[model samples]
Target: MGTAPVAVPHLPVGSRLLVPVLAATGGSGRTTVAHLLARGLAAIADTVLLDLSPRLASSWPTHLAARRATGLAALPPDQPLTRTAVRAACAVEDTGPHILSDSRAWHAPPLLNLPELPAAWYQLASIGGWQAVVADTPHPLAHDLLTARHTGERALTRDWYELPYAIPVLCAPATADGVHALIRATKTLDAEALPLARTVVALTGTTDGRLPASLRTALAGATDRTAAVVHIPHDPRIRAQGQSTAHPRPRTRHASTRLTDAVLSAAHRMWGRPMPLAPQPAALP
Candidate 1:
């Protein structure tokens, strides 16, 4: 009889992972993608969505504010508050083992000082026992603010690579002009910070399966290194749903779903583990 195969031990259900998804430009559907990815990751383990953008809190679900107040009230007056306060404030729509937080709310003028931000973030991550943190940050603004705080001791004129985390995802538009514009912008950013080519995932927005040939040619011509490209086809339901206050009906071909899959796939590859897939729900006709 053949010897029994050795079985490998399984990884704990929740392993800490930090993923930062950024846009080449504003309005590239970065926030939408970040939220969907958070929801999808929740399917696997406890996930927290941290939106570092300035206006993230205003657009967040209503219940989030009440939650923050409750958590804040519980803290001792002398002790510094952790970033988890932001997460506690958000009303979690699902009972799944996840906490989705819009970190943008924490970006108020009071929180702008760098000394407080990083310390708070570190403390929050340590205390929450979070399995993963998916952060959505404003392009240059996020990078600049965090960098200034991290290296406040150094002269501002000196070149420094300051960031709370590495950028793994770089989202861009699918149009030729968009790609060209991004390429130029990436070059400028690379001069100061890390290269965009090192991104593990590059998501492009498209209207249909048909991608612009010019954009394809430009990406091909460029020597910038990129791991993969995820095409997000335009879906009217996403926009139409956003127009109304009601929770938009989730659709099968929704752009968020595609974006989430790509992010999770990238995470799986990086961690060398299989990520659980979100259940597919039936779409309304």
Candidate 2:
């Protein structure tokens, strides 16, 4: 008889890290950065990418609708929405060392009122060794403001101070025009949501070298809780591969190498230990 398959242990890492990546603007490469970060964190510990953009029409809506269709939606709306339901619907087979969950589908305006669901999902992910929860936040200031208000009113059964974990990583494109737009949007939101600033992640497109002074000032002016900037060069290689859901491609061998290095550096700054980088294949001709 063939030898029994080696039983691999579940939950590879000891501790979990939650990292939310949002954007100040819409096209600031939030999704790309979130994916990159998840891939990077996978090297050291288990990583999951939670896409929180409701507009993306991800699986969350379908799952929620299905639950309602099956008459399960009436089962105590106050109860936190569990991953059991979502996992079942999403058919998440690969709960391997790293799992990236796109949580954006549930961010719909209608779902925002369903506070228990998002909170419950987050809690479940935390318990499941989800080391990193990278979020691709929305663009408009209204989005953040509404989220904060709704989150407080609906999901603040726990200490209000701990809400930062649920906050997203805001991304702002690295163009003069984009940055200006983001500044206006963030400023308006900052008037009401103080924590909004902390979640901003500025995304600079391929540039010759260092960040520009104007963009730096614009980011500093924001009042969010934390800010991080990631620079993605304008590489035809990435676009040619069509990095979207319909044509998802693995990070290019060259990009993967640099991304791993950058992620390691960021991880050290954020989580103390630097993780091993993912292996890179030979560059394409």
Candidate 3:
């Protein structure tokens, strides 16, 4: 499908917003949510999409049709990570946010024995002068935290969730198993005393219409614990072709807009100040 240039919003005076979209399981639409959120925010401000998924499994490179393989992994470890260096590492998209993800060939040897710390990536993004950074995180720490046996390991993993600038966008599918996993994930967060008051829950619809009555009941109880819940409509194009830069259906676009508005609202309420308004795109008639 063809793409158009993404509209840039008027510059707003405020610290950059970091949105980390995370999920506990695969097929939870975490990456999709991150993509849409970044696209929406990119229309409102200068935004960057940071793909933190493992190199072999990453989708950003393919979805964005990035021409370069250079990304976070390509940055020289010895050099100071300045804004210019970070910008140089990104793959520019003609119709979306700058994408920073490992686009190396699948057959290439691994560059590092371990992934870079989340803090380092966040710091790099913070200094890049973008108004927002939408991070497609690998997975939630709840699962790893449950299996971790050592106190030090758990502490280090838990620290990843402690970013003050991050606004969490917890994603899950609108299905029985997905809802159940979300419950467990939330319970783990509560157990760790992590903040949820600023979280935005995204429930992606796999089928048409409302969720099953039983699932809705369970989801309602779970959603009540977060800042807000936004539903993503089922997009047949995406379901068939996977995530791409193709324009989504009207309903899906509306849902994405609602999610974006909710996130901005959460930021305003949390900081006790109104965020500079962006001229929103026209809603579906």
TM-score of each: 0.62, 0.53, 0.85
Per-residue CA lDDT of model 2 for 1-285, tens digit only, reads 999997532223444444555444456666566655555555555555554544344433343342232222222345544445533323231322233233333443344322233444455455444544554334344454456576764322121213323334445666787777667656644565444533434454644455579777766675334444444555454445433322233333334335445434444554355322222222222
After superposition on all CA atoms, what RMSD does each candidate show versus the true structure?
Answer: 9.9, 11.3, 7.9
Per-residue error for 251 in candidate 1, Å, reads 7.3
| Per-residue C-alpha lDDT of model 3 across residues 98-117, encoded as one tens digit per residue | 88887666677887433446
What TM-score does candidate 3 get on C-alpha atoms? 0.85
Higher-scoring candidate on TM-score, 2 or 3: 3
- Candidate 3 clashing pairs, residues 3+ apart or interchain: none
Model 3 bad stretches (over 4 Å): 1-14, 64-66, 113-116, 148-152, 155-157, 274-285
Give the alpha carbon lDDT tens digit for every residue of 1-285 in model 1. Answer: 999997632224445555566665666666655666666556655666654544333244333554443332233434555546545644454523233333234434443322224324333554555655666655443345346557774322112122222225656666766676556545545555654443544444546566567767776654245545655555566555541123444542354555555555555554456533222222212
Top model number, lDDT: 3
lDDT of 3: 0.74
Residue 199 local lDDT, model 1 = 50
Q: In candidate 1, which residue pairs get closer than 3 Å at backbone N, Cα or C atoms, i.e. clash?
A: 51-103, 51-104, 64-89, 64-90, 67-89, 68-89
